[model samples]
Target: MNEMLLAAFALFVAYLYLPTAWLSGLRPAKPMTRQANHLHCPENKFYIPEDAVLRRHFVSQLRWEIEAALHPRPTDSILQRHYDALVTIKLEQRLADMGCLKPC
Candidate 1:
């Protein structure tokens, strides 16, 4: 009786844990891809508080990044300024794309 119980438990464990390829045909999984048009937040899904500190915190980070791009380290070569300008341009373009900044 003990041997029969052990065999049953082993069979149960194998069926529960083993990956059987034949079961794949029952339901094939597909990867989910985002639709190009639905990139922006779905109309009011979340509400961000209009706190002054929070606003200043986010603005300060952006300001610091622009400032860093505008002024490279003294040890860097003059060519680094050109790279910085390109970085700034790309940042502005992305901000424009996200509707955070208005392009002239």
Candidate 2:
């Protein structure tokens, strides 16, 4: 019975993940040009350098900021608060242009 339960749990997990993986794979990937431009936030005020290494670092930092904002936790330590603040400010300005957020 324990073995059957384990098998069922594993299958359930796989069932949940497989469609997400397949759908992601099926989605058309953004072109490289578009990706290159992604480093430029909506405001166009803050941007990662065009260099690939810098762009990767910027993306990593952005992802950390986004995750932190979405999932605030008492135990979590912010690794890049200053940089994240700057990015957040720039993003807010951009969103304000679209009337999404009040201008600062």
Candidate No. with top TM-score:
1
Encode model 1's per-residue lDDT on 10-101: one tens digit a residue. 99998788687756766678665553234465432322225779756755566567667665544566767776677667656545555522
Runs in model 1 with CA error above 4 Å? Answer: 1-75, 100-104
The list of candidate 2 runs beyond 4 A from truth reads 1-44, 72-104
Clashing pairs in 1: none
Kindly provide the TM-score of model 2 when superposed on the true structure, using C-alpha atoms.
Answer: 0.27
lDDT of 1 at 44: 26
CA shift of 1, model 2, Å: 86
* Model 2, residue pairs in steric clash: none
Question: Model 2, residue 35: what's the lDDT?
Answer: 35
**Candidate models: Cα lDDT each:** 0.59, 0.59
Model 1: lDDT to the true structure? 0.59
